[model samples]
Target: MTSARIALVTGANQGLGRGLVEGLAARLGPDDLVLLTGRNAERVAGAVAHVAADPATRSRVAGRVLDVTDADAVARLAAELHDQYGGVDFVVSNASAMLTPDRSQSAQADDFIDVANGGALAVLRSFAPVLRAGGRLLVVASSLGTLGHLDPRLQPLFDGASLDEVEKAVESWRTALHTGTAEELGWPRWINVPSKVAQVAAVRAVAAERRDTDLPADRLIACVCPGLIDTALSRPWFTDFSGAQTPAQAATAVLDLLLTERVDPATYGELVRFGRVLDWHDGTPPQLPDGLLVN
Candidate 1:
């Protein structure tokens, strides 16, 4: 068994995910390993090469092909991790999809629900058993996904909803979208918003479940917004955004949560922005739409 710590990041072929893998490699001990994953084998290799190009991080980096939406692929990867590393110390669930503006509404909703929300759930469910106790699970989310943007009538339910309730609420939104009644039910037209909202809620629910089941009492699971980063996902709409941080800067905020030894109850299942925790249940207005990049 290896004594070095292990960290895995998904969708790391480009953008913030790539930056995150680089950042992790730079910070981890030489004996540590940072696994970068993506759906495309070639792209994953390219990212691995880029990160390994640095002499300081070269020996600490590797890559794998993984599509979060594919259950079999995720399960296979989990089994591989179990066999090789026993388990991982950190999992950055950075894989997500944002539909292009030209996509049809139904297509957009499908990508949001299936790729962003459902895919994240699949990753967490498949990897929960492989996440070492006291390890951190960081779900990269968006500030726009805050509960404040959700329907007022549904606020109370989300404020304290259990895992099952959150699942049902997400399903309800899916049904509404398919039935052409999402707007009537107060779901927003921005497809990514509802998906991320559910994603963040699910993170909280998962943390609560872990605590209630007495599993990994020290496990840290939370969602965070990386702030506006100049990435391919955001360049379309945020080319002139003055407050946008570089991908390297955004990666620091994520690493802060992943590498911290101290755990705070307030941070569990919370949406952290710019390294500060946000009150998910509070109805305060969310900060400006910083960028669209999920990471």
Candidate 2:
């Protein structure tokens, strides 16, 4: 018999997370294992029970209460995975907390940092160890994280942006929108480019690190732009997207990238947007830079 592929998905109890859990569970055979994780024990139990009730998926899915923010706990879980399952073939970091409440109000510098640490980097460190050789690590990131795409464009929105010119451009755009003259200037209310770009970079960085090492086996990491799914983090404008894909659609897209074997090494760390894979460049995807590891 073929060895069962073992997968672990964080924030797997609801919305996009739950959608991914169900989609993946459906694709894999009964022998395969998919661990559904959440912070709430009751929620986790419910998620597990729901999966377990389905005859085709019941035997393959299990539940675990995991908080990705806790470094120690994350490390311990990684070790546990190593011991119990030997290694994990897929690790999806889908947990994220938005600071819009703070952003719109008295959100302090610490709050933004908290999102980066707790919501972004923390998740990366947590699953670093459990990833099997040739394993795939997928990080669910926002379009806001893309540096060149948004930071420079919206200086006012972001107190400290990396790209000054881009920030200024964004500030100008923001001002135009507020003055009831957005139609004259023609600008969209929402910007998703930055987050999408940043997500790709983060995933690529991890994949690049794993590729350059002298390890005996190969591994891949890539970020997926889930389009727009209906979730708590979603903004009101998201409803307007006529054909906006649902959480299930996003989950399927993610799984498609994860299951595909023909992805070139050069494209490993790049962003896969709109079902098309592309590299990081200014405005458009760039060609692979030399001396930069692509494998």
Q: Which candidate is the best by TM-score?
A: 1
For model 2, what is the error of residue 39's alpha carbon versus the real structure, in angstroms, after optimal superposition? 1.0
Encode model 2's per-residue lDDT on 236-292: one tens digit a residue. 333465666678877887888776655456546556655566434434222322222
Cα lDDT tens digits, model 1, 34-135, are 999988999999889988997757438888888888877888888888789887788888886755555555656766677677667777777777887677
Give the range of the ten consecutive residues with the poorest summed lDDT in model 1.
286-295
lDDT of model 1 at position 111? 61
**TM-score of every model versus the real structure:** 0.89, 0.71
Note the clash tally of each candidate. 0, 14
